[model samples]
Target: MACFHPLTMMLTLVLAARLAAAVPFKNESYPLTTVPGERPWNPIEPLQQRLAYINATAMAVSWNTYTSLPDEEAVVYFGTDAWELDRTAPSRQSTFETSRTFSHHAILSGLEPGTEYHYRVAHTNCFGCSTIPTYSFTTALPAGDCTPYAVAIVADMGLMGPDGLTNSTGKGAGGALLDNETNTIQSMVQSLDAYEHIVHIGDLAYADYFLKASTQGFYGADNVLTNATSIVENYERLNEAWYDQITPLTSQRPYMVAVGNHESNCNNGGVKDKVNNISYTAQICMPGQTNFTAYAEHWNMPGRPGPSQNFWYSYDVGMVHYVVLSFETDLGEGLYGPDEVGGTGKQMSGPRGKTGEQIEWLRQDLAKVDRKKTPWVLAFGHRPWYVGIADAVCEPCRLAFEGILYENNVDLVLTGHDHVYSRSVPMFNHTADPAGYDNPRAPTYITNGLGGHYDGLDVLDSPLPANVAHGIDGVYGWSRLTFANATHMRHEFVAARNSSVLDEFWLVRAREEGTCVDGEEGHTGKDNGKGHGKGGKKDKRDVLARLDE
Candidate 1:
């Protein structure tokens, strides 16, 4: 038997008590402004990268300020080629829930397409602070043009550390860590010359300090399990670091995004249901706010028909009609019953008599896809309707949206959430509708959720579903889509660690005049003027009839 000293025993008892009383979010500090030199007057310069709405000939920029100054206003100065010192866009200022931090968003409109513009963001009253450096961005190619472009897709991108422990600023998980995932995609940054659009499916900056501590075995993981104040403070810190990491690349291109489960907390985007992500709503500001508040506050996205800003929306880039949606809300994840492990009830909101709003929205959106005009209709969301993972399957999600995707003849359906890279054989209704590479009859489903997060990666099922073509896990990577032209497009998975091309395939558009065309040309996926594609007066009233039954 070993004898313990009285002092040692006392210390051990104290430690045990402390651990036992640890709260999930119990920070005593009121405001945690971690950004160096973050002043209430000057504030931290807009850290998040600028997001572009190319179709509207405008760009939206946002940043965080520690405190608000009386009569203080946020402004962005811009001009073609150089800052003409003439044109200015005033910002709409508002405060977030995390702290007294003020958020500012300014939209610079009336710009020309495919043209260069220089700009700077600043406080209207900060007289002594040096002006923010000028950044340049070129507007996207004019809409309706048969121009060639590429889109880079990344998801679940969490904190990046330099020594696998600390980030560029020598901070670890508890601070503004580096985005190694972004570092891995540096080549994609270089490829930016060709890829102008960057789309993040979901799960941006896993700063869930307020939720609970992460036990996924990563050091300095910013999960403060004891303090609420520290939680918000650490959140702002991690967020600032995240914005800084992507600023360099995003400043030059358009960064589009979709919401995921992580953003479902505490009024984040005005939501507090089965999923509660208060941080997401407070952080991201998009176009549609009456329903989704935070998102509406930040982004000036195009094609917002009202109601929900980040819920579901559509826009056209070059020859592609891009649809962005929210799976957490769109799939009725919050409306399910018992909230138990497996026992569930009602996948969507409202009774079963009528199709839900999202389903109806989808039907109308898909019915309007004029292949001849845009050539390809690509739909993206955070969660995948069809995925083959041992513990991450969402059958209800499939039941919710797969039918609409198939009925619409969408070319490619991209999703993230499974934390792995997977491509399904052109699939429709649980069968492998062989449309391999060229003219896929069924939309090809690809999951690129391996964006390197501390929560770890997902495992693959021993035997994949019959419709799954390829699947890989235990790797970090992103997906790339190259719109070769109106008729052909290429998709590839690039390993982030080394920028290696992991998987590649080509999706050919089925033209009305041909059997299965592979080369680029006009009339990519036109409506054929038969009430199917475009300009068809096919009674759209039946949009929800299928769902009702």
Candidate 2:
């Protein structure tokens, strides 16, 4: 064994600590310096994705482009019929970082509700390019409409590869696929007909993994600018691939999303500059981060519109009011501190930053939900308040926000961060409601972050809590919330590979009170009588075949 002098050992430890603090991804060695005049390139033509229904009367359309056409505006042409285009809405262009790419967003307003409209997006500068096919989407019906509808909910979905699976993890382009559960995201897209819209809870592309690993050599070789450049280039490539994978679905259906830890832009310093908010706003047009980037410039979400940013807004779809919140931001919890697991932690209120807004906003937002109009209230955010995973439990977030949901009579709280699926019995303040999911006073929490990613599924920690109704791991899947009517909602978790439903439950909203009906364990997608089972049972499940038909 070799021994070192005390002073030498002290110096080494200090140097190691400095390196760890300098960059967010300690395992990767990214350049602290800039590579001038080196921008990533993409040849794909501009196509619209990330279609969001800002309201019944407005739809926000956004897309990306690598090649720029100067002095031209983005536009969308549309009408009730595909060929007879009767409307044109012009868009404003924006970019997050100079090295990234440009994104254009435009809102088509004054559309009739419950009607399908055909539309196509075109760039003003791409006159020489051929036109793309027309797409169509149905505007959401008004509250109390009692229209039966379904929505696909997922989060943490990464990129795909030549095999139509998540790209393998590697150093550069076409890295090795880390998780075999790649097909779930694509499967969701393929089965888009089963879903009226998609609520992506967060962590869309997982490009940060590439950025982090590439910035530091995968093998810790101390590679600098070269790796950093590759990081940006790889992000660009992954975005393009992800765009293609999702365009088929997003173009024709409203794809709503929330900000996750991955999309926090902590790498570039939290919505500080154009590079941070550009990509985020270009697609989702969310709230919470208004200034410091193009978020305010590109998206036009619903609710107190002046500058809410979509951070905390509620929109009605059928008989349910879907509330979107930004748990990624400092949501009044003491989660933000100097020693973040990665990157500089989210900033409190500062120059060009926002904070201490969610609880108050939520307080008012819930205060206005009229149960008579929108009988069912569902809330979604990036992080989960409760999970069986040890390191993944966010009790502080629960302490800060769960009370608001419980008080507001929120029926369901949907979240995705643990990369697994877990359903909690109707709960309040860490205690299961005595009613046992039947007319419970609290909300039912479901964590369905398993939209497939390089990180793979999270493992179950010891001593599972009693409130947990169902928990599954090592499966790639998405949840479908089918609003059968104002009084009934069916929640199903369908496996992506075999299309087997792993778990399910029903929420029965009676005129007097709401009752939660738990399905059998490993129930296998069959009628199990009112979707309620007292004892666990194992049975063969049927395949959904295909959602399109």
Candidate 3:
């Protein structure tokens, strides 16, 4: 055996680099996927999705194998530097039926933030031996201050309607209406399944209903999420109804969810667990933001997240503060919540925005608003101030909170229950003005419940105050939000049917500080502010591959 000198060690490293065809920019630019599987002639190859999502402080590392392993458990070896084999972590033993699709989510927390970590993921479950070593990512920055963030937002996706989708898939146009489509929203678990149900049920309570009756509050209490076999199975069940549906236009985007009434209802409560509510309304769980008026454990969001419970919570992404509101929560009485949970007189009187607590939080939150730091405040709920469909009390919350928004100088208001694309002129307290008199920019409003939900109220039926800018109807799609660094933000309604830009508008705030008033297109106070209503580059992760890819 030749004695390995120091120079010999260097030569060995060089030789290894030659043998391993280095893949640079892995830990840098993402979209890192595994290699393909082995062919009949080729040696057993590595699966595509080897190491899953690994964050700065956490890693969901996972792997798969063909045969059963001799060992009894699956282990993931990771470290701060490269392969520190010294310190490590072992995951719980898990086994799932494998046929091109077998996996598990292992959330590795307690990781050091803002630090580099590398390691290998291997499985020891009944399989002889298999491991994928080259996988890594820097831990995420700590939650508060400085750390940047991004998220995907979707509405009325994976829906079923009379669009004649024989497949019911809603998986980005292919894979049949209800085909073998993978999870289109893999990056973030959002779906148009409610819309799919709208279609599966023939866009009506049973059939032959207009947008008002059929799509209005289409949120059934069936707990369709529970009724379906798997999420993908649910996607397939309504195949024919929404076969060619297209979404995931926001995958790769770490976005949260804002419930649409169509999501579920007190009646749709069919989950295995006696769910307090049928709607699978997710809780952002920011600290000091929950009501916990429901159940003890399950009703409460796991992982001591940010705050708030029912739905109101503020999260930071980059320099933006996204406040997602729950329309089904308060809104007077008939809306929901409070009663089952508690009300102002009954419990606290109203939901956050509609109640004293939330209003107080809003006042303080807005009072402590550091526009210099955040620069952007975007709020989203599942109801609209205007859907173009003439309906009484369609936006009761708007009536209640528009003043709150005006007084607080809110930036934007996004809602989606009307099922149509309508961009309102920055109006305050039902007043149509483009000047955004309360602040530099009027609180912009965009209704994006278009992601292929059962098409409804395909007509402008709302009181189009002179402040109304542009509106579209029956166009199934989503809203493309571009956060162009602080001061500037743009939004466009992407039509799901043909991937076209339907209604487009933007919230352009004045750089100079002071109060500005927004009037109708006329009122001629400031610059006409006319430009290409809609034009911009597609979000790199618009429709990402959220599947076993």
- Which candidate leads in lDDT? 2
For candidate 3, write residues 1-549 as lDDT tens digits: 012245534543543354233211112122222211221121111222222223334544433333333332445556544525334455432332212222322456676643444555455332322222234443333222222123334454543333322234222222232242222222122332211011110011101111122122232223233332333232222321221122121111122444433322111211112233322322211121123211111111112223244245454433455565655455543444422243211222123344444545555666675665556777767666654554523445665466767776578777765556677767766666746523344587766554433323345665553555677764455555554434456565655444455655446665434211120111111111222111111111221221111
**Model 1: runs farther than 4 Å from truth?**
1-44, 54-56, 69-72, 83-85, 128-131, 162-191, 209-225, 266-298, 303-307, 332-355, 513-549
* TM-score pick, better of 1 and 3: 1
What's the C-alpha lDDT at position 449 in model 2?
A: 80
Candidate 2 residue 306 Cα shift, in angstroms, is 7.7
Q: Which of 2 and 3 is the better model by TM-score?
A: 2
Give all TM-scores, in the order shown: 0.72, 0.74, 0.51
Query: What is the number of residue pairs that collide in model 3?
Result: 85
Tens digit of lDDT per residue, candidate 1, span 1-549? 012245534543543345332211122111112222123233554545466663637777666555564323567777653525457888777654554356676778887655556676655554424223456665655445554556789887754443121332321223222443334334455555545578888776554422322222242454333245544555455554555455555666777877655443321322122223332233332222112233444455555535455457777765688988666554543333111123231111212112266767778888887676677888888777567674565566677777787888888888888878888878787777765767878888899888765443777776886667789887777888877567778888987656778888777876665322322222222222323221112211232231122
List ranges where model 2 is wrong by over 4 Å: 1-44, 68-72, 124-128, 162-182, 211-228, 266-300, 303-308, 333-353, 512-549
Reference-based lDDT, residue 291, model 1? 28
Q: What does candidate 1 score on TM?
A: 0.72
Clashes (N, CA, C under 3 Å) per candidate: 28, 18, 85
lDDT of 3 at 239: 25
